[model samples]
Target: MKINVVKGTRDLGPKETARFQEIIDKLDSISYFYCFTEVTLPIIEHAQLYKRSVGETSDIVRKEMYAFEDKGKRLLVLRPEFTASIVRTFVNNKIHALIDLPFKVHYHGPIFRYERPQAGRYRQFYQYGVESIGVNSPLIDAEVITYGYAALSFIGIENVILKINTLGDDDSRNKYREIISEYFQKHIHKMCHDCNERLQTNPLRILDCKIPSDQEIIKKAPKIHDYLSLASRERFNEVTKLLDQSDIPFEIDQTLVRGLDYYSEIVFEYHYYSDEGKTLGALGAGGHYSHLVKELGGPDLPGVGLSFGVDRLVEVLKEIEEDDNEEDYNSFVLFYLIPVGDVKIEDVYDVLMELRKQGGYSYDMYHEKKPLKTLIQKAKKRDARFLIFIGEDELKNNTLTIKNMKTEEQMVVNRQDAKQVIRSLFFSSMREG
Candidate 1:
């Protein structure tokens, strides 16, 4: 019987693995330069942690979460989001006192969701994100946005429009919720089940409904800008002022209410527009989830953050055929040893390893290990940079013939010197900028 891997997930082969690693490594390097330290949290977090902070009515907590009971009957969930876990870690460990204010951190890991798989959406996806804790200033929100922009730029994803909005403070949102709840009351029967439930508990969510009818209806409805209090409006202005001074382009979008609950003041999403002039879904996005602190039993410290779907970002890279540049990847040299039938294969194996041990060149010819011509073809298939021949003739001369695969140049070097010579050459080839 053949058992296949689960759907909505994929295995990254060698080339694909390199592509994904390059994206993360570039982001990590750039974020570190900005003084954002790296932090990690467990994949499984307490179920109540999300339920209490992300709001019971939010889609992330109400449905699509992978929740189960462990041996002790303790409820746990595969983390669907990051802000809650990061906050929980900050409070439990007392990170604020140990670190200075504006505790900035970046995280990269897999996040779980039970939603249907799509072209770019998956049940198991990866995210690379940064969070700033213990700061309520609008400048913190602006700085997080700048970090996110720099990260995407570092990864060659620059053609994205930054759509930003504000949830306003508690005092500003109450009246807007009242207006939306009353309007939805009359049209409750017209919305999808999720929107109907969202109407009663979180009228703001109605703006995010995917249904065409709901989208059309909400367009004419009250805008969040019209209801924002004077102080909240000034804070939004301050965030944009910083963005303007930093030279990052942005557009005001009142309908950008995120799916999470604890977001307030400033929220944003990065929408990538293809060269063909269409929004190619979200490449990477994040926002200020400030109010989730006190809800998670921590101080009323505010925070701002952003996370990009690694799976979706990878898809965009593939769609544009950007990874085709052969020069961008590192080249590893390889040697193929063809064991003549009469020669003891053990000696060939021992010598080949000696070349690899003291020398750093990589090589393999596990299959079709026959004549020189066949072995050379195999080396080309593996993209080997250099090829070596070990046969009856080389054993007698105490010498080895190495050929540069690209230039087809051949050199005969002493057996002992080959190790030291190749070690220096290989290390120089792998040097970074």
Candidate 2:
């Protein structure tokens, strides 16, 4: 019987795996530079964690969550997002009392959501994000946005527009919700079924509806900014001002209420576009949550964070690299050992081990006895920089033949001097650079 991968999931082959690692490494480096320590959270948590923190009215809890009952009669769910789980970790561990005032942590892993798979999206996807807990200042919010922006820029995703909005404080949101609910009630028949349901549960969610027919009605609905309380508006202003001072370009999108319900105050998304001006939607997004920590049974501490869709970012990187004709440096082989006519594995095993042990180098050997032409083709296929051949002649003369794949220059060197010769040839230009 033939079996296949589950729908909406994929196995990342070597090239994709390499690209994922490269992107993750770059983001991890940047996170460390910003003094954000790494944290790993479990993939499964009590189902109520998301339902309570992410909101039962939200789509994730209402529709997208992958929930199941364990054998122990316990309801569990594969985490749909990181923020709530991270907050739960903080609250459960009493991290606030254990660590500094604001606990900054970064994390990366696969998150499960049972949604329709689309381009750059999947039922199972990866995310990298940072959360700064126990901080309420708008300055921290701005810094988080800047950090996300800087990370995307570092990953070669520069053509992004930062779309920001404010959900305002509790009072502001409550007032607007009532007003919007009343307005939508009058035109609810014209909107989608989900919008109609959202109007009854969380009216703000109507603004996030994607149906073309509902958009006309949503567009005419109230904007959150007009209803924002003085304090909420001032907080939004401070965040924008900080961003301006930092020279990070952004747009005030009044309709951009993030999908999660816990988000309040300032929220933002980094939207990427193609060279021809086609939008690829949000590559990453996050917002300030005023009550998430307290709601999760922790102190009434505020937090801010953002997360990037790793799968989407990898796709974007592939596009950019393709457009620029970039080389796959991650796959470039430093040395390829070829065994020619009547060459035994034992004859070149020492040299292979030596090259492998050397720092800042990668080496692979053609173990099977193949013709010289076939060996050369294999080396080329591996994108090898240098091809080292060991055969009867080399075994007898105690020498090695090395050929520069790019320059096609060949030279024989004493077996003991091979390492030095290869380093001098490869590192000369790298050192200069």
Candidate 3:
């Protein structure tokens, strides 16, 4: 019997992992320039934590959470999202007290949900995000969105666009909710079940419904900006002003209401388009939360953050990869070491270690029984740039033979000086290229 893997999940082979890491590295590098430090967060947390911050009415908490009761009869869950967990860590650790104000930190990890998966959506997926806490300035909001856009651009994603909006603070949202709710009530019976449920729970979420039939009713719903207070309006205006000054293109999407309860004021999404201009969906999203920190038992510090769905972004990258006919950017082993006649595998391993220590891309053939021709062919198939043969003759003579597979050029160097010679050759090759 074949044991099938879990639905809504798939394994990432070496090629995928390499591409994932490349995107991650670029994100980290760009975040560092923006002064955001890295923070590691737990994959599991108390189920109540999300219920508090993510809103009990949100789809993620109400339906998608992978929740269970542990042996201690305590409810735990594999996190469906990172924002609440990060906030919980900050509160529980008293990170505010230890760190300076306006603390910025980034995180990358897997998140689990029980939703029906599809292309670019998974039950177990990865997310990378950064949180800027302890401030409420609109500039910070602009900074978060800018970083989100920059990250997608850095990964070679093309034709990306930013959609931003404001949900206002509690007072504005409360008033706007009342208006939209009453409007939806008139047409409630004709809408989908989800929107009907949302009309009673969180009316703002109804605006985000994707049901084709509900969208027309959603479009007629009261806009949030009409209810925005003077301060809230100016706050959103300032965020747009900053993005404008930075020359970052964006549109004010009045209907953009994040699925989380904590998100207030400014919210945004990075939408990606393929080279052929096909919309790939939301590649990244985030917003500001004014009450989350205080509600989570931390200081009354306002925060803003954004998260990139690594899985979706990977899909986008794969599409671009095929379109551009790009070769794998990950390292292809530069050389393969083969142990020949009467030479122990250890001999080849020693040279392999030295080559690696000097930052040379290399691997070793352990079984000496394989013919030299076969080993060379294996190396060629792997796209290895060179083959180093450790034979009894070379071992006795204390010399190494390095052959450039592509050019069919061979050279001999004293074993004691092999590392330096290889380093010089590698560096020279890089410079010439």
lDDT of candidate 2? Answer: 0.88
Candidate models: Cα lDDT each: 0.80, 0.88, 0.86
Q: Which residue pairs of candidate 3 clash?
A: none
Compare candidates 1 and 3 on TM-score and give the better one.
Answer: 3
Tens digits of per-residue lDDT, candidate 3, 79-178, equal 8999998888888889888977788999999999888888789999999999999877988998889888878888887688899999998899889988
lDDT value, residue 390 of candidate 1? 67
Candidate 2 structure quality by residue, lDDT tens digits, 1-433: 9999999899886677878899999999999988899999999999999888999989999889999999999999998999999999999999999987789999999999989989999999999999999977988899899999999999889999999999999999999989988999999988888887888788888888888988888888888898989999999999999999999999998889989999999999999988988765799999999899999899999999999999999888778777443444345577888887777887677778876776567888877777789878878878788888888898899888988776778899997777788788788636534
Candidate 3 versus truth, CA RMSD in Å, comes to 2.3
Report the alpha-carbon TM-score of model 2 versus the true structure: 0.93
TM-score (all chains, Cα) for each model: 0.92, 0.93, 0.94
After superposition, candidate 3 runs with Cα above 4 Å error: 323-331, 342-361, 366-368, 431-433
Of candidate 1, the 10-residue stretch with the lowest lDDT total is 325-334
The digit string of per-residue lDDT tens for model 1 on 1-433 reads 9988777776666666677798889889988888888998899999999888888988888778999999999999998988788889988988877877888888989889888888788888889888889978998999989888888888888787888999899888888889778877888787798887888789899888878987888777778888989999999999999999999999998878888888888889998878888665777666776668778777778999899888777777776665553332333345655565455667678778777677445755444346666766666766676676666777888777776666677777888888776665456445621
- Note each model's CA RMSD in angstroms: 3.1, 2.5, 2.3
**CA shift of 419, model 3, Å:** 0.9
